[model samples]
Target: MRYASITERLASLGSEKWAVHVEARRRKGQGEPIIELTIGEPDLPPHQSLLEEATRAMHAGRYRYSNGRGEPPVVEALVRKYARRRPDVTSANVLCFPGTQTALFAVMLGLVEKGDAVLVGDPLYATYEGVIRATGAEQVTVPLRPEHGFHMQADDLERSITPQSRVLLLNTPHNPTGAVLTADEIAAIGEVCRRHDLWIVCDEVYEELVFSGSFASPFDDPELAERTIVCSSISKSHAAPGFRSGWAIGPAEFASRLLAVSETMLFGVQPFIADMTAYALDNPIDTSARMRQSYKSRADQVIAGLADAPGLTPVAPEAGMFIVVDVSATGMDGEAFAWALLDEEQVAVMPGSAFGSGGDDFIRISLTVPDEMIDEACRRVSALAMRSGVRKELRA
Candidate 1:
């Protein structure tokens, strides 16, 4: 039995959260009332307009293979999106993809050749290093210090770049940590990228879901405008992950290459999905108000609940919808704690180490669950902490 050598690459990139989540699902099948907060799935309905537009397109027989690059409407919609804030980019700068996850890889693969380095933030989204490795590029990480509210600093990037570094990957409204980089930070970072001659890739997937304040991007920075590539998805804003609607916007030359790669890789997204996504982006919704209201309420509940927890401290997020709790005092690594909590209390959360070793002493909790569910999960988390012998102290 001969297997492909490329299959070895898969081992470098499996999500540990899914293994724990599957077990939680199995327990639920056996009648356990488990609360699974391991994945960043928003428990909300997709927008009515998105649904209607997709249905309209499908029924109107607009379901054929796309123009082999992008449905014109979808590409143009992405253009108008950037135009609202980044008038520098025209329709030629947009490249549509099946999903933002693929766009992440496509940009790296399309731009940086093997042996070049892709610099990223420590404790980043789990797949980042894997994607870099698969592209045969070295993944260099700049530390995002807890002292700095887990935000990526420009000085850090300035010091980390070596001669081989070719790309700088930035995630605003970051995953796992939930930290949003400010406009000043973006500009400063872009200055560093410009000085060092690095291609900047900003993953703004959660751009529209910022809970506390407005979002900004370096793509809007004129200094780095030519060197920056911004990739995002309709999945988060529309609450329609299954639609597989995503795109990349960069310089005209790079965007053309990115589209060529995207077409060679996935041959463009389904026309109906792209049409729905275009409609969602063109006729934007004030979903930020809705997200801010719901997520803040839920985040406040989690933060308040963890205040009484024995050995955990929930870091208050500035924007994105996750609470990363420092659990070093628990005398257990995040993976051990997450499994124990799931087995003993039927509550599922992601082990922070899966994000990176920087998160080994922490755990990430999503605010996607209902208020009551988070209450129960936090109660279980507090109980787990108490087992480390702080029960009497915490109760008192």
Candidate 2:
């Protein structure tokens, strides 16, 4: 039997056990207890106001088709929502999507041409490189190392830029590294991007999830404003990932073209969710402080529990719901440690390699799990590492 080839188009494909583990547990058909430190999903429910508003809209029979570009009132609300920092921003700057993931891909589709290259931070969100790859563009990298607090530096970026490079994809409160760019870091990046004439697509999905450090967007600089495209979602901030509502804020023309490309690509996000999403922006959810504090506590505990574990060093994070543990000292690479722990102790976590090249020696721990699960997962990881003589010696 002849079949179409999926190989060429999806060349960069690799297995990520996080989603696999999630489904595997569900298929057990009953009480299989799996400690999931894999996915970034929050255990918290959606905001009370958002839930009530969505329910009312659903009951009112607002299920009819919405404008493919997005409903006007929601777009207007989004304009006002972001106007504080971007005081000049109007509805022209906003384009809504079902999820930031889709908006991200749309930005590439609208901007990237075949054979063009995108510069991405190494050890970025696992899906970023995949998105850039799907656009028939090559994804280049500038390493974000622990010695540099995992922050991406302008010098490294300048060195990596090539003639084919057309875009730089950045994430703050970075997914695997949790390195939030400071205001100064933002400026350095902006200077380079402008000098190189590169399009800047900055993802601020964890904008409000910062703990030790503050966040500053590339769009904060007026000079970089025209070149910057900002992507964010209500999923992380509002603890409503299921809603799949995300948006892009950029120059009006690009926003409109992006809306056209995206709506044509996926018909714009679900209209119901889009409506409730707008209502969310208008009503606002104040879960920032609580989320930050709880994630910080969980991050602290993850490190403390692994204190006596061999070859493990905690990379202190400034923001975001995840912290990467340097498993280099454990004499085990990330994949080896991750799979061994999962097999031996039933604790599931993502191998750093799942993100990009610089992640080979690390593993990411999610703060979305309950406190007891956090304790248990960390304990199991530490116990496995204890079998190493170095861990025993360090304990003594």
By TM-score, the best candidate is: 1
What tens-digit string does per-residue lDDT give for candidate 2 at 1-396?
Answer: 754443455555534435445543563345556677887888788878888877887787767776656777678888887787778898889888878998898898898967899999998898887678778888899999789999999999999999999999999879998898989988998899999899999999998898865568988778888899999998888899988888889998888777778767776556567667878777747776678899999999988888877778988778888989988777778888887777777777888888887999999988998899899988898887876546547766
Worst 10 residues of 1 by lDDT: 387-396
Superposing all C-alpha atoms, what RMSD in Å does each candidate have to the true structure? 2.5, 2.8
Clash-forming residue pairs, model 1:
none
The CA-based lDDT of model 2 is what? 0.82
Regions of candidate 1 where Cα sits further than 4 Å from its true position:
1-6, 284-286, 390-396
User: Roughly what TM-score does model 2 have, to 2 decimal places?
Assistant: 0.93
Model 1 Cα lDDT, one tens digit per residue, 1-396: 878644565565765436777788889899999888887776777878778888999999987877546888898888888988877778888888877888898888897767799999988898887777777778898989899988899999888999999999889888888899999998889888888899999999888778766788888877788899998997777777787788888999887766667777887678888888888887857665576677778878988998977778888877666888998777777888888889888888888887888888888888888889889888899999889546435655
lDDT for each candidate structure: 0.83, 0.82
Which residue pairs collide, candidate 2?
98-244, 311-329, 311-330
Give the residue spans of candidate 2 off by over 4 A.
1-7, 11-32, 389-396
